[model samples]
Target chain A: MRNRTLTTITVVLAAGALALSACSSSKKNTNGGGLGGGSSANNGGTNQTYKIGFVGALSGPNAQLGINERNGATLAIDQANASGKYKFKIALNAQDSEGDPAKAPAAATALISDPTVVAVIGPAFSGESKAVNPSFCQASPPMPTVTASASNAELQNQGNKCWHRIIPNDNVEGSQGADWLARTGAKKVYVLSDLSAYGAGVAGTMAKELKAKGVSVVSSGVDGTTTKNYNPIAGTIAASGTDALFYGGYDAQSALLAKALVAAGYKGRTVTGNGGKSSVFTTGAGKAGNGWYFTCGCQDATIAPTAKEFTAAYTAKFNTPPSTYSPEAFDAANLLMDAISKASASGTATRTSVLDALNKEDFTGITTQIKFQANGEVQSSSLIVNLFQEKSGAIKGLGNIKELN
Target chain B: MSQSENWVQQLPQNIIIGLEQGSVYSLIALGYTLVYGVLQLINFAHSEVFMAGGFGSYLVVNGIVGHRHMTGVMVPLTVLCGVLSGALTGAAIAWLLEKVAYKTLRRSGAPKLAFLISAIGASLFLSNLAGKLFNRLPNNAFPTYFDINHQLFKIGNAKVTLIEVIIVGSAVVMMIFLDRLVNRTKLGRGIRAVAEDAPTAALMGIDIDKTISRTFVIGGALAGAAGFMFGTAFGVSNLMGFTPGVKAFAAAVLGGIGNIRGAMIGGLILGQAEVLIAALPFVGAQWNDVISFVVLVLILLVRPTGILGERLGRAA
Candidate 1:
């Protein structure tokens, strides 16, 4: 009886293990196939389709920004498809990276392996883009990637020919932000960065620019994740009597700092880089976010004119207005399709041919005129600087603030 | 100026910020220590329980309150709901883990190593489960309810807000209450008895299984409270639990795995250390995690058995 019972237990355990493995494997296959399947659909000659993959955080804490990018990309693709200028249908394979550096490579790898993918769109945040950029280096006819939101200088400095981005790097954004602070007649600026590559790089760059403009960088540093209360730091900033504060980080910490700074009686204006430009900051900080300024690559209102029809189509499809990155994603899709059409016109749609076409192409996007320099940084005329208002809980885009010549 | 004045003047503001932030870490650490006191297994998924509490409160506040502006009893009530949800989830997770993983192994006389492995698996499974269910996005935000921007008080040159007061005060109160319960209550005796010797306690008519379950529930409740506090303090996200979980675990180990008081002490020390490290003039803020792990390693090196040393018969 004991021997039979042992066998039964063993069999039950094995079955359970098998079931768990099967379920997990199936989920992985679905995501993997979802990314690669777009490429396969494009392979059929009569119904030639081009797939572009956009990887970013679509549903996490950073969902607002990622969703916007996704929406922008989708709108652009829809317009391109409607124009009937391309022989193939433009399909986007979007996967969420959850804003994690570790998961970005896997997502990028999956997208790059797809044979029919002409170009890649994003990994959203700079940290994720930097994490995944190394993988594109080894791909045959290297994957041409256009980061929709990545701004860290390290991404451009990666020395990889395949990496390209439409957004201004942190150097430009940081310089502009510092200049804004200086314009406010702030003699001393207190700076805080998140300590991530994106945060530190931007903060460091801003400090350099602030010093160059003869403004004192009174104090600068990072806040640890374990540290929750920001009042003490805000108190210190107020006590230092710095004229303004510049935070180079994402919305979560920025919101907390904004609240704390206001509570601590810092009357000066506050500025943050692109990562901090989100509705979350205004919402989380509430009325304290009033008069806060932020700089990003594109303003939603500027894109609104070119994107009105796209927005209407997106609302018709997704039943809501596209989030911030959607227009960029839409533009990316169009850029890819434009390149693909040019490449396919020569009989075969080779990756090299597609890349060559992408290199020479100049497409006007909602955000900027998308043209890449040798290093793949978009050669744009200006970056958007916006003032976030607590009442509207939205960024009032102040158009493109031209770069200082 | 005097040398002392000069030193004070030169001390970086960022370091002060780091220390203030450490206060939250201390609160989360208390929960980990309390649970480990009786049930020696590290409550690996406690962080997720805290995350659930935050999200739960966000849902309630966003869905029910409907008003953009929050005030009066609404903030406290929302926090309470958040705490309750977190506690309930933690309790459920602890009970399920015992029933599915630990209980069977204990009954079969499996080695302790097996239980450790199972616990790790459970932690990974829970984290991934949450990731899959929620779209693996790390940037979700807790719905803003209370506006914490108003200054509540100012000390000399420093200003403090109601939010800071709430976070620091509540954490302290909870810690004291937990200490009193463990030291003075009959339930606490039962917990001590079980921790001392489960087989002997059972022989003395102390329901071992029930005590363990109760211990888990209490720990879960504490973790839930921590989660609610975290959401209110720092905001919420799916992966928000990860760093806190690791830190809380570090605090537990720092305090001594089965020593309740040790966890409390360890947590405060770790929190303060992390903040101070981040605030250091040269180090700045980005070294927060780097500082935390460094302190953890130092603690382990200096006192491998932790501040309190492991309790006998508590290796569940």
Candidate 2:
């Protein structure tokens, strides 16, 4: 009786495992094939189709930012297709890196392998951007890449020719934030970084700028990606008795730190970089999230005059308002589409042609003037860093950081 | 004040924070130690069981509270509901895990390595399954039923929050209950017999399979409760179990792998060491993980087995 029962149970378990494995394998095949296989052979046909790849954290902690960017790009593509203006149909081939550098290479490889993919919108977070930029640069004919949200200053030093970011680098945002702090009468500032490429870069710049402005700076780093409890760090900050605390990290960690600081009874003003500008930060930190200042290269699309239509369309399509870099991503997609159109105006729009067009083209976007300098940075003349504050549970823009005084 | 003076002032609060964090680690560590006691197999899927408990409690709590602003007695009642639901869910998952991942292999008489690999596979399957079922957002927190950050009391400069008190109190109560259960109950004797000599215990008419299954259930219940506390303090996510789970596993090993009481001591020591060592101005917080492993290595070198020595049969 026992033997029969055991055999039946074993068979059932084995069948279940097999079924699950089959389901997962089939899902992968469908995702890859369904998205990338729609490439039309361009033999002088106006109905030809091309894919624009977006590689970012579609899941995980940074998913909100990536999802926002993907939605923005998707909206642009849908609008362009529906407008019947372009000769070719534009499709988005989005790959989820889950914000892990280890997972980025595979995601980037998947995009680069798809022949129809002319350009990529993002590798979203700075770590994933650093991980996948080499592949994007080293691709045959070199794939053009533009990031809407990655703000690491070190990314510019990577010397990748095809790399471009619409947003200002960490150097700009960090300095502006420091200047704002100085103007606000913060004498003793505590600067904490997550030790990630993005966090460290911004924190280092902010600390340097603060020191230059004669502000006493106490600096430290924690690997916020792995550390869950911030109370010990909060204790150190509270004990330091600083007037302002500046954190350079993503939303989740920053939110936790805010909660910890509040729990520790630290009354100091709290500030963070663009990485903490999402609704996740406010929601995660709860009431502690209120009255915190955020410095970002991206602006509020809902309030931008040029982005009114874009904002409305995004809200109507996604059933949620455009957030964070959604407008920047919209501009990036539109910029790429413009380049594709410009490149194809005279001849076929190959990867090389698209790159040439993107480099040479000067266009106006909803966020800023879309023009890349020799080193793939947007022209400094057009780049601006804005300050935002969380008040009464909503993140409100406080205008340009330079204009904050 | 000077930096040294600042450090001295911060020491009391840092210790309080460390103890609060350590208590949760101890609860999770008990799961690892208990499973190791009977099976001599490291169940990697236990982490997923922890994650499952968090989600399970989240569903029950979210269903009960919804968007309503909870206050007064509702807070404690809600927390109790969450803990019970979490424990029940964790026990169910762990039971299923043993049946699916361990039982089939055990019946086939597979090697120990196969069991380890299967546990890992099961862990991946369970976490990803959770991600697929729930939204994959990392910051999915419980509804604010009450002020989790409300100050319950204070130790020096450190304010002991309500959540911290609940976590530490529950963990202590559970650990004491677990210790007594293992030491005094008939099931305890059966478990000890199986751990000591499975074949001999089977010859003596104690059903080894039932004892092992029950042992897993007990461990799972503790982990599930820890999961609820952890989720309340931090947020719940599919990947939430990885860090705490690894830390708890380390605590289990540090306490002498199979020793239940040792796991408890090791967890407290590890937590205190991590927080206190990282609190030093020169060392900084980034070196916290390194300090934890270095302490582990140093302790292991001295004791060879662990702080308290290994084997549940000999110790518990």
Candidate 3:
């Protein structure tokens, strides 16, 4: 009788363990293999709840960008829901990617598994966008990912039918940045990247442009995300006697690099791409951050005439001023909503219908007029990248990138 | 200039930077060595202890120098306050760790493997707790009261900043103080005795538990102080300790895991190797970690035990 009871307990425990392992294995597979059996059959009707998913860095070095984007999207969603123009209610499924490519797949998988999610706002940085775009494109109905800030030029050529970018890619920003640098009379430039898809792509383009412009350029790579010490790299740059240092990475690492360069007595023109345009860089670099230059496709919403009302609303809602790409995110969210609205006009909005509508969208936004080319690139005539400088510890806009040349 | 000339020009500054980086590693490594000396266990949670010190000091420093332009004597005083607070916080956490993770497990007669598991569990809990409470940003700078990067001197075209001076100077002083504490005092003797043979030491009227606890406190104080210097130089964050912590652990092993002096030497060597090798014109800075570990492996292969192989019982 005792042996029988023990055998029964063993069988029960084994079964429980097996169930636990099975559950965990499924989660692991979803994370690794991307979303499978992908999109759910969701019919967007009156009073139906649809989730607009956002995947980006909610908490990390690049969190300000994601948070800014999230806030803008949130405002757009709130405005849409309150307007009562749409028959369906929109809810945001904001997922944190932590600005890491390795962590982005899981966040993307989470959104794809949900049947109600028709559109995604961002995968934020270019590396994450690259990592998750295939999965998004491979989803059953192809979940549409409308990115606000990912600017890698090669992203549009990935053959992902559902991927759309509202910003001008690195091909424009990088060449424009090189032209500006050359106009600055910098004979030699040291180009550095964080080795991310975005950083490398932008830096690569900049190097090619600089070489074409007859400027000597030296290129190197570093893992900006985990590296805390930039002193050695600073020493390398200082010793090279480069007239300018072009860093293509996020704000936090750039700030550290700026500080290290100062300590190493490097008196060169320091410039970075849009990724380093945050107050995090300016503040973290302290006095060293002064005189650093930045190139960005984002507009200064606080000063822009068209963005006055959006800025007021954003500040009132989020308590902080709208940061880089906030206006763009607002536009992207509105564009998505317009697509969703169009999709639902005839019948119910599905992932495929919303994507089709997105491909055909041509709306005027605060930043620029948005329109996508056949390859998911923004083809706006008014698309502009601006040059910004940190003077006396505050970032000041220095007009347009094209005009600088 | 030639390629080698460039490296030669940059050598002095790189050495100064490496020294600053190495000193912090030494201070943290001392804690790991101290714990291992008595318990014969690697406390994986020591990294979190270092991180906690940064946050603790950040709160104190931020409270004292909030938006105020500190001048004159107030600058050094504020720094001193930060270091003291960090040390105290680290010591308190280490004590709690010993009681909860080590003592309880030992009292229950748990296997040695359980201790390692518990230490890791404690590390995860503390780091996540820190993230939840403090800023989760990876580079949360401490409130800047003084210019941390003000150039104090130049040697061979290499400038040395005030923060570097403070880091190396304080690390040397603390290591000396720790050396005396482990070799001179009655507590030191007790700790050495316990580390040598806990059962026999108990037989000789030495309180094994108390000595072990004090060892942890001493190590914790040093690490906490290092955390302050590190945070001041880089920035404070819940996750700041991982890299330095890993480097310090390797340093401890490189110098001889249970030897106090060995840990110090190991850390300094590791730091310099990382800087000099990575600063090579052809190699680049991305190879910093790989080069340092390669040096460590080479050294270990040559001297299997470490650079200084004597255990804490004899070396301390």
Instruction: Point to the candidate with the largest DockQ.
Output: 2
Interface RMSD of each: 6.4, 4.5, 8.1
Q: What global local distance difference test value does model 1 have?
A: 0.68
lDDT of 1 by residue, B45-132 (tens): 5676666655655565567566666678977777667656655665666667666656666566665566565655555566556555
Model 2 lDDT tens row, A189-241: 99999999899999999999999999999999989778777888988888888
Candidate 3 residue runs with Cα over 4 Å from true position: A1-46, A380-382, B313-316
- Candidate 1's error at A357, in angstroms? 1.6
Best by TM-score: 2
Tens digit per residue, CA lDDT, model 3, A171-230: 889999999999989999999998888888999999999999999988888887668878
Instruction: Quote the lDDT for B156 in model 1.
Output: 50
Worst 10 residues of 3 chain B by lDDT: B307-316
- Could you give candidate 2's per-residue lDDT for residues B139-179 as a string of tens digits? 67788887888898776666788888899899999999998
- Please state the CAPRI-style docking class of candidate 2: acceptable
Question: What's the TM for model 3?
Answer: 0.92
Share of the reference A-B contacts seen in candidate 1: 0.28
